[model samples]
Target: MAAEVKLAVRGAGKRYGEMDALKDCSLDVAPNSIVSIVGPSGCGKTTLLWSMSGLHGLTSGEVLLDGRRITGPHPDIGLVFQEANLLPWRNLMDNILFPFEVKHQKPDHGWIAHLLERVGLTGFEKNFPNELSGGMQQRASIVRALSLRPSVLLMDEPFGALDAFTREEMNQLVEEIWMETHTTIVFITHSIEEALFLSDKVVVLTPRPGRVLNTYEVPFERPRTMEIMAGKEVYDLTYRIKADIYGQSRMQARAAE
Candidate 1:
């Protein structure tokens, strides 16, 4: 059976003064499914994500979470950005607990311990952000976002700053966590490989005034490994997505001219 839809974007449009960033884009994300949005730079990928998260309002249409329109950010959603954004002054445990601390809620020590172990940061709780590697910092940020037990997680190029190897490691860790927690996720990334590796559905968008170009359903099974990326199917899909992105850029350029 298909998964239940947990989030929906209906005929969404976004504009910044005279410039249109997104137009008539619609998508449905399933509960516990990982959906990744990818496109050429400046294609409104981030705009669409923010609109869905209710951090930015759409010019038209609506963003729905569990059938209710999202007018603003809610506690049910968690967001992670390109930068880890951990407070350098706070140690790892305190960083992960920051959200609870700010909300004045009692930290669930057991759950926090499990999260630290799940991300392989158990012993580094007292260590500062600078003491950890880039990947480690990102891990802390992710756990911190999950600290609230949000049903939906929005990640915008969270691992984009890490080296390729570190990025792959982080991807594996994310997949592992997703398998365990099954949180609905909307991830935005520029890398086709990363999108394919992490997403159940990869949504491609057109350049500025972005619209949905295509949504590819990944066929690979869960607990995926690096070897799957080298397979013929993955290679073909990667090539096709790259070609489509380039093709869209060419078409946009010609239209501008």
Candidate 2:
């Protein structure tokens, strides 16, 4: 039997004035699974991510967690965006513990320290955001989001600002975090290969007024390695995903003409 859906987007749609950003985009995320969203530029991937996080409301549908409708931000969800967005003055440990202070909860030093080490930020606790490298700052941002131990994490191209080598390292770190915490993640990115590398399922969306074009269940078993990305199957799936996106783009253009 299929696993229980930890997060569900039911016929979700969003309209910005006359612009329809998304339409009937529904998806299910299984517990402990990594699901990646990919599509052409401006296909509303980030909008959908926000909708799931309950930060943005849908015009037509609803998002649910454990079958409960999300009308606004829930304690069980956390967000990480492209930039580290850390406060320059806070220092690593303080930044990671900021979430606890927001909710008026006491900080969990043990968990924070463990997450810091997992993301390779252990010794940098005393360092300010500027003291860290780009990748290190991003890692600190991730640890901050995960600090609350939310059941679901929404990542909007969290590593898009990093260099290629650092991006790959961060991707591996994302997988490791999911494997360790079993936190269901909905990652948004434009890179097909990166999506395939890190997701249990890679979901492709159509151009403007984004809708689900296709979903590919990655056949590779975990713990996944970069070597899987070099295989023929990866190339084949990549080709198919591109074809789906490009083919839809062409059809949309013709309709406009």
lDDT of each: 0.92, 0.91
Clashing pairs in 1: none
Q: Report the C-alpha displacement of residue 38, candidate 2, in angstroms.
A: 0.3
| TM-scores of the candidates in the order shown | 0.95, 0.96
Q: 115-205 in candidate 2: lDDT tens per residue? A: 9989988899999999889999999999999988899999999888889999989988998898899899999998898899989899999
**Model 2 / residue 140 / CA error / Å:** 0.5
Candidate 1 deviant stretches above 4 angstroms:
1-3
For model 2, the superposed segments whose C-alpha errors exceed 4 Å read 1-3
* Candidate 2 accuracy as TM-score: 0.96
Candidate of highest lDDT: 1
Please write out the lDDT profile of model 1 over residues 32-77, one tens digit for every residue.
9999999999989889988888898999999999999999988899
* Ten contiguous residues with the weakest lDDT in model 2: 219-228
